[model samples]
Target chain A: MKPVTEAELHTYIDGALSEGARAEVEAWLVAHPEDAERLRAYAEQNALLRSLYNPVLDEPVPAALLAVRSHAWRRYFAAAAIFALGIGLGWLVRGMFITPQMLPASLPRLAATAHAVYSPEVRHPVEVTANEEEHLVGWLSKRLGTTLKAPKLAPLGYELVGGRLLSGPQGPVAQFMYQDARGQRLTLYVSRQRGEPRDTAFRFSQEDRVSVFYWVDGNFGYALSGEIKREQLLNVAGVVYKQLNP
Target chain B: MDRRLIIEHIPRLRRYARALVGDRYVADDLVQDTLERAWNKFYLWRPGSDLRAWLFTIMHNVFVNQARRRRYEIEQAMEEVPAVSVRATQSEQLELQDVDRVLRSLSPEQREVVLLVAVEQLTYEEVSGALDIPIGTVMSRLSRARERMRQLLGGQTVMPLKVVK
Candidate 1:
């Protein structure tokens, strides 16, 4: 048999050898048990790595990470148009353009709708639970195309209750839910805005059952919505904005 | 079908990312950025070509770029995962000591070569294209990584082989 090179040994360990090459290595291994042991060690390394991360294959893909058909391109163009028209003329202009019939999906309306739908759930409120804060933060940040922080509303008596990924009219949106002592829930809905960084001061909108305070800072549309009092929601929104921006 | 093709490879992309970054969140972030880049460059992907290899090539680029942006974070991640220690004596137990530590023990380039070859089971040619390194570099890195793993899992127990390259 030909002398087995180091590369060939590694090849046999990876099972990359041709039948003849594999047979030669097997024959050689019988004479060289040390080489066999080394080959076995390399095989074990592969097995260990495969077993360790193979679970990721079985993990249900995060909703934020799934193959979402880009449904919001229309809303994407609308939002871009909205921002383009205004030199920071902001969401009021957004409000005037959206007809009641079209409703066309403005930030606060979407935020409030998400809040109304999700906050009332007695169980299973979030897609990524708060305990997995790292994954939740990382997932939301990527989808929104910005580094997102689920603002610590702990000072305002609201604790992060986890978050979910929602497909909003304007691209992928992230809703982070926070709960107060009385079980009242609030959601901070975020959507990525197009174009350059432009600031839109806080815009307040009262939907059918939810009050929302939303604003656009740079490239993100943020709406803090809840069934809580206007003053209370606003206060929490202020805290959220400061924590996110600051 | 184009979209699903990208989605189909996400699991492997994620598993490789986890091995690369050493944290689930960071791993997902890597996968997300890879997916984002893949989408932006979707037109560049030739349909009939090895989609899996192309996706991995894109991920390799993303990982390299992100590593440049956050060199400090990668350094921190390179540390032995907290629970794994040299005290792990038995070869079997050592192999099981948080694959994170065993895998992260290799340098980034070395780890990439090993993972692509052993874990992903890509051909040496595929790894060369994916890492954009020469096939010779891939082979050398693979041997070095395997040798490191052998020592990492108590190679002292086995007699050393005669060939030293």
Candidate 2:
């Protein structure tokens, strides 16, 4: 019979050993009374730990935590309403403004273009990867003169790949990239804008293969672009908006 | 992935966080943060992967980050003050209170491993994934943690205390 290693014993206590290995450990334990006694002690310790903390699972989730989902949906509806109003207003003033100055591409279009250019890159997708999230947030916050937090997107099935600093027409732009399990990537482009805080509305636009959901909050304009459906992108955008606003 | 499916893990997340932080309010805050983060990046989660393990991983990262920030705060408040150590002696019989104290007495790394394995019932591999540690490291830590727990609880007999007539 092979000797039972300490690591194997640990795995046995953890209930992680294979069935055959477990049978071997059980047979070995039956022969070694002292080892069996020690295993019993380990089992008792696990029981104690569970008895001490498992009641927490029965407790009602606090209101604050429950509020996250409700708050997100509320923001989603608000953004949708504002978006509808913006579309209506855009059509009303479609041909009214023809100024001599050529209007630069809208931020959403610029963001989608940027997303198309970078999201497909296999290497060098971001300047600073998500592994250095603290540095990424700090650098971008400093460069943009606003506190920027990279939204946690793990629940939405995207992990931050990295972020980059890009030059915009107005100032520096921060682009955060996230990749899903299937290797699909999304980019969040944030830029500083100087104007009366005119819009807090969320707007959607598509450029080629990428779709963008953009919104202006305070001094920052955020554009989330990906090759994803509008409804799905809207849900992600709603989360980003709530986090940024909160 | 459906948000509802992620929401189903909240109770377990809270349980793990409560054990991890040893504070109810702080645990709830960690859960809230974890949920918000998870909801935002829900796409990154693989369709058939263990959602619970993924949530625990996020909670672990949040807990670590918060601990790092709090350590900074403590340092700033009292510079160069050595932390006081509270050790459990074997003389104390392993009552429930003693178990609580001993669990809290563990170093954070050991405490997390023990809690994830014993309380949360996560497999060693799941713990390794959640903690971003090697499986060997997880096994070694679990071994040490279980030994410490045994020494702490070994002497106690669970027989009821006798009452004088």
Candidate 3:
């Protein structure tokens, strides 16, 4: 029998060898304890590598990083260029402002996109249903690292459909979806702010047909998005703000 | 080009980057660079070919360039800071910290090769394509990397494949 090379030993551990080759290597390993021991060490090292870094896959990809796929986000290229030039992208985007020119780069866009994508889902709009309100709230609050309340929209003819944890620019965000008798849906998107925790008046940002009434209160940024009239959304937003604050 | 396909690969790319670069921020920066490059020249990607491998190849280029520049900066700063990992006297069982410390001690080339195979579970051909190294180089580097790690972390209790979690 031809000698199984060290490469074959590594390949056998990796499960990359063909069936015949693998069988050949297995036979070789049975005859050779030293090489088998070496293979086990290598396999253990791989396990360690996976254990150390696989958690990253579960982490929310930074909102800035997610925005790179948008062609409208040409500005991100400049940030990437700066990063490539040795400037931390984090620092370059530290003072991010939502100007009309940088509108696509705003948190409101993220909120609006989240609303558009989710509000239309019929059967599976939320990860946690409103039936398990406490569980939903607790799960999202833990993820967003803030005490979250699914505001009472029933008074305004909309019932809490449910809520979900979303990936935001800074970290995990909470989105609470509400539906009225007419089946019109609205989403309140809550994301944490990294800047100084100061309260700001509600700011309106319209993307396509998604009208978002957003505000910054303390460390959290809230955006209420719906396809309804601005006045109606504002009224709901007012009620939401009041219920949330109260 | 549908950018959505690129988005699907982001998690795995981030995983590889996290392993390739120890710092989460730096790892994400590499991922962002890869995303940006893939988005810009998305037309270059052959449709039938492996999108994950293509994205990974782009990540490899971004990582290598950033590492070259970072190595220069570290060299300039005279910051031999990686030595800070507390060495365990007894390798009774290789803890996460000990594993990380040993991995950092590896040469960057070996680290990437081994990680592509072990962590990402890429095939030898896939690893070669992703890292832009030949098949022979991948095996040689994997062999050398595992041998070095064996020497550094001798007698570690074999743990289950953590990927199961």
Q: lDDT of all the models against the reference? A: 0.75, 0.74, 0.77
Query: Which ten-residue region of model 3 chain B has the weakest summed lDDT?
Result: B156-165
Better of 1 and 2 by DockQ: 1
Residue A194 in candidate 2, Cα distance off native in Å: 35
**Model 2: CA > 4 A from native:** A70-246, B72-94, B154-165
Give per-residue lDDT, candidate 2, residue A209.
82
In model 1 chain B, where is the ten-residue run with the lowest total lDDT?
B156-165
Each candidate's clash count: 0, 16, 0
Q: How much does each candidate deviate at the interface, measured as C-alpha RMSD after superposition?
A: 10.9, 9.4, 8.9
True contacts kept of each: 0.35, 0.50, 0.59
Over A126-209, each residue of candidate 2 has an lDDT whose tens digit, in order, gives 989888999999999999988889998899999999999998888899999999999999899999876545334455567888
Model 1: DockQ score: 0.21
Docking quality of model 2: it rates as incorrect
Judged by lDDT relative to the true structure, which candidate is superior, 1 or 3? 3
Clashes of 2: 16
Clash pairs, model 3 backbone: none
**TM-scores vs. true structure, each candidate:** 0.56, 0.52, 0.58
Clashing pairs in 1: none
